[model samples]
Target chain A: MKNLLFFIFIHVSLFAHGVATGDQGYIQQINGINFVPFMYLGAKHMVTGYDHILFLVGVIFFLYRLRDIGIYVTLFAIGHSSTLIFGVFADIHINAYIIDAIIGLSVVYKALDNLGAYQQWFGMQPNTKITTLIFGLFHGFGLATKIIEFDMDPNGLLTNLIAFNVGVEIGQLLALSAILILISYWRKQPSFITYSYSTNIVLMILGFMLTGNQLIGYFNS
Target chain B: MFNAQQPTEKDLPTSAQLLKSTIIAILVTIILLVMVILPAEYGTDPTGVGKLLGLKEMGDIKMSLLEESQNELSQENNTSSIDSDSLDKAMVNNTINNDVVEITIEPGKAIEIKLEIKSGSLVQYEWKTIKGGLNYNLHGDGYKGSQKFISYKKGRMVQSDSGELQAEFDGYHGWFWRNREEFSVTVILQTSGDYIQIKQML
Candidate 1:
């Protein structure tokens, strides 16, 4: 638990800075069908994307079946992939900070849904799949905005984008499996119940933090 | 089937516990921002702890690089907006003497033609690439051994230019044209000015 807290703190601190200059230089300098490198970069981005991970964690917290997991994850992937391509190709100009804040709110929404807060307070359950897909669109737009800021060359852009999306899927799968394995083991412990509540609460708090940070950045910038 | 794994009310945290956890998370976030994010992103360190951790330099570099790149973009826009037509009207009224120099510059070759003029002398000059655009610089070099040089204008792929120049100091003043095209091209230069002499410096 202590190690996890340490990891979370470090991750949050590092993640708040956004994309590094080295990665940005790589993006700006490259052109044509740089499939492998762009794909690698895309995968690397998804893996390090704390916002995406937090949302994913909230999403699968209650799922026990592989089919259910597949359905939800695939929906998210579809939504994310479509918007990512469209946002970049259509030259969508939404501010990244705003999109990121919305992505943060998606995390908060999911955590609250996990805690059954909405169902309890309002005696209503929002459509989880649609909500997930919607947030996935926001997440995709967030990715698109960051890449657009990289000022990548237009040559072979479509091919590079497709390759990047593939990389994102690969990264997402790798991260999802790791979380699943860890959670499966934790579920067997007697402290799982106590820990789960605390964990979701923490997740919700992290979500709020992300939202607050991005909102502050938006106003300042 | 999807609803089977829904959590019971017992799995949820009490409102008080939730509020406490939220506060703790916010506190952690604030601490991290003060010590790390602000220093590393904006170069603003309120706690002074970021400097000790060497994160402040990272932030400083990021902020400076962003500002540098933005400045570069603006400079590019400014250069692109420099058109030959901006000085054409001004050059018409100041013409006093007309001298035309025509030269055929070979591919990948350059030539420097200058006019020896006195300080404060006014000159109206125009040049055009008859075949292809070339890179040109309008500059002044002081008298022999003085080592003084001043740039009046510089441009790339310019086809034509007309301007009136006021000599800042007594020196050889004029254009250096480099033919960047694959083939030879002729440059026609017309000048009307108060210069005492015209000669090819190089």
Candidate 2:
């Protein structure tokens, strides 16, 4: 598990700023109703998107109820989907590195929230649900920023975007399921209480690392 | 099953501890950025660790490759726009005529074929050796003095060639094929174009 976390940290930090070149090329060249291909691209992205997965893991780490999980996840989906569609169609552009840095912050926020850092340090508890939703919007815009850089063909843009969104949701569900199983089992272990703080601390560290990397990228770029 | 209560003191860290952790996280992030991220992402290796690990080169290659692809895409876009313009003009008063010619060349022999064409005329052509490969050159000479030759393309040890060609000047434009094989080879040339005549020049 330590090795895996280390691997993910290295992988995510290394290729954090951009999409794969071949995918970018395909997105740029293809025209007219490439629904299936676009959907596949979207699904592939979400599955491989470590930042999104990390944030999701943190968000659901403490939630024990399926209903609460569903509510939060749904809120996140709605938030991200709105901006993804709007940002692309309305031609709203944001610097990818800056948005990615904010996405990094989202992970840190959730980790800190899980650790009860707000209550401990500030003596106040912020609304986790609303915060999740807001960060979800930022996540969507993060994806939008990358997609817009592809300069995708405008033909069938709406259809392709919708299909892509569906694929993203599917990918998210798949990732969430795997994470749920692992955490559920971990919660059964006696070391859960002892290691939970350490895990959150690591998550926070990863968040800081991601943020720092992207900020460096932004300034250089 | 949701835990509704806010965190108790036991569930949280002290303010000083939290601050300490934050500072450590920041320091660690800076270290990673300097030793790993800089070299791996921007090929800017201050600590030389990235270069030692070859991560700096990896980043450099990625950056260069991306720039090259962007350059290629822009070039493709420019060419496609030009092609659309040419296609529009090509639709006006265009004439296409097809011709099939079979010529046999003896071993170590050569031949040239020319099509009388005006500048800016489009020709689609294909030529193949029935048995073996040959060296071929597609070229044109301007009708007037001082423009002796312009080469369009050339291939060696080629069995077949086919493509569209646009004449850049009023000239006799076509291909020269040389059979370097031991046996005589028959070349079948098929052409469809705006050319007026085909002349075989030995």
Candidate 3:
């Protein structure tokens, strides 16, 4: 059982930031408009995106009310959508590694905020909503840069992109619902108070791993 | 409408404690990155621990695959540029016709037939194995030992195939057939196209 779990962990880590090889081949070979496949790809991207999921988990860690969670998640959605649509259309190119590192830093920032480190170290709270929105933009750029790497055929480009964006939103909703369910169940347990702090620490470590990984990629590339 | 309690200020950690936790997180991250991630993802084993762990081989394979894929992408771009040049030149009279060749391959051996074709040139080809099926790769390589390669198609246990191939760049475009069966196989190739030369590449 331990070996199986270790094998799973290694497999997941290897694919953490990559499109599956078969899907990558499909993307390269296809020509013209492919709405459904692109949309599916978008959804798959979000469902497997560890960095985005980590940041979202950190954002909602402290929120207890559903209304507050909704508001925060919406802000994040809008922030990412704007950049994803505009960045691709405008052909705004950013180095993927740099943007992904920033995304990792966003995760780290949220984990620290959840730990109340900012309040203790700096004696002030950074406006959480604005920061979420800003980081959301960076996350969107990460997605956009990856798509740009495909050099996709321009036929039906706009419609395909829109479909992909819609798929991302749907994927976000599904992921959020699953996370909310898990968190709500965990909160009811007596261990919640004891384990919450440790969880954030783990999250911070993951953020650092992501950052380090991307920085290494940047230099290697 | 779940209402979980948020920790108040008094329940939060003190400044020194927060600092300590942050430092610990950083330290753990650094150790993992240096000892595991670097060697497993990029084959960069600075601390030598990854080599001992047998992860350096995995990293090496990943890096080489990445390099190969990047080379394929560059080759595509190079061919596309050559395609435009071919269009501008309008080589309508350059088409060659009915170039036929046959080669015998022993069991567990491979052979290649390459055509010197420019980007945008079109060719029609048909090949058949007389005996057992053979594995084949339709691929191209860049001009003058540029080392750029792109695979157009590949198959296993193929007895025959026929299709049109448009050159992506100025390169040697060809078929590689490997007879994997226990018996020898004879491949009869018929090609007619806009190409300068055709030869067996050993």
Candidate 4:
């Protein structure tokens, strides 16, 4: 339990929307379409992105069917890919801190939905699929703003963005596979039912932390 | 079952209870954000807990490094967008001259020499230490009241360095040398370029 808390703490503290410095330098220096490198960077960003992972975990927390998971994941991917490509191509530069804060709120929303808080509080269940897709859009904007900060070379930008999107999908698949396996294993235990409530509460807290951190950054910046 | 069993109505908490849980979550988030995240990441310690835990120092260093990088980015933008006509005019107005100056730094002492150069101007410089190696930083201060600082390069225990420096802004560009050895070190600095003036800063 202590180790788990420590892991979450580390993720929360280091949750700034930035590419690695070396990767950023490479992005700025390269002029033409560099398909493989950009794809690798995209995968790296997704695999290491705690905010995105947290949201994904929330979205799939109660999902027990593989088909449902596939549908939801596809919706998320489509939503994010549309915004990511369009946002970067049109140079729609939203403030990163603001977009990140919204992404954080998406995590909070999902965690609350998993806890059944909306049903109890508002007496109705919000459409989970729609919310997931919308939040995915915000997440893509967060990524787009970070990329814009690098001032990437315009040559072959579309092809590079497409490569990056494909890499993001690949990374999502890898991460989701691990998560699904772990959750499936855990579901066979009696403690899974007992501990589910507390787990969502912890997720909610992390969501709030991400939101608060980004807001502080927004104000300070 | 297609999914995890949904909680029955009887098992669900009351609306008030749900609100209470939310308030608790928010409270916990606020406490952690103020006590841990602010101090460890931003160096902002309001309740004094961060300093006690030795996290404020990390925050301070991160903030300074962020400032340094932002300054460098702005300097790069400034240099890249400099008007060629203005650069040419500045070069024509400033006569090219070679100057060699030698300064001695006693043990644990430091000295700085600055050249007044406009944005996009270029200068070639060579500096070598006569005795033991010294720590050196090549940096610049922005012109006027702009609170901009750019660090071009930094090195420790360097005996000699030769390079061409292009001004990123109209400012005082220079090298600061510090002798950490027990004995004094003399630095011979030779510079030739399009600059308005060169002087040792007191």
- The collision pairs in model 2 are none
lDDT digits (tens) for residues B1-202 of candidate 3 = 1113565555444556545655665675588578766775677999998777655544554564455445444554466665455444445535576799989998755677988788888999999988878767788876533545567887666899999999988777889776657799999999998887786754
lDDT (Cα, tens digit) per residue for candidate 4, span A65-106: 668899999999988988998899888989888898888889
Clashing pairs in 4: none
Give the lDDT of residue A195 in candidate 2: 84
* Model 2 clashing-pair count: 0
Candidate 3, superposed: residue stretches over 4 Å from native: A1-21, B1-114, B117-139, B142-147, B150-171, B174-202
Candidate scoring better on TM-score of 2 and 3: 3
DockQ pick, better of 3 and 4: 4
lDDT of each: 0.73, 0.73, 0.73, 0.74
> Quick one: how many clashes does candidate 3 have?
0
What is candidate 2's lDDT per residue for A93-162, written digit by digit as tens? 8999999999999999999998888888888888988999999999999988878976776778899899
**Which residue runs of candidate 1 sit more than 4 Å off their true CA positions?**
A1-21, B1-202
Scanning candidate 2 chain A in windows of ten residues, the lowest lDDT window is A11-20
Deviation from native of the Cα of residue A196 in model 4, angstroms: 0.4
Residues B1-202 of candidate 1: C-alpha lDDT, one tens digit per residue: 1222644445544556555655665676588668766775677999898777655654665564455444433443464333233223334533356689999998755677887666788999989987787767688866543445677886656799998988888666888776657799899998888876677644
Which docking class does model 3 fall in?
A: incorrect
Model 1, A162-206: lDDT tens digits are 988998997898678767656655555567666777788899899
Question: lDDT at A159 for candidate 3?
Answer: 83
Write the candidate numbers in order of decreasing TM-score.
4, 3, 1, 2
Model 4 residue runs over 4 Å out of place are: A1-21, B1-202
Report the C-alpha lDDT of model 4 over B150-170, residue by residue, as the tens digit: 778866678999999999988
Better of 1 and 2 by DockQ: 1
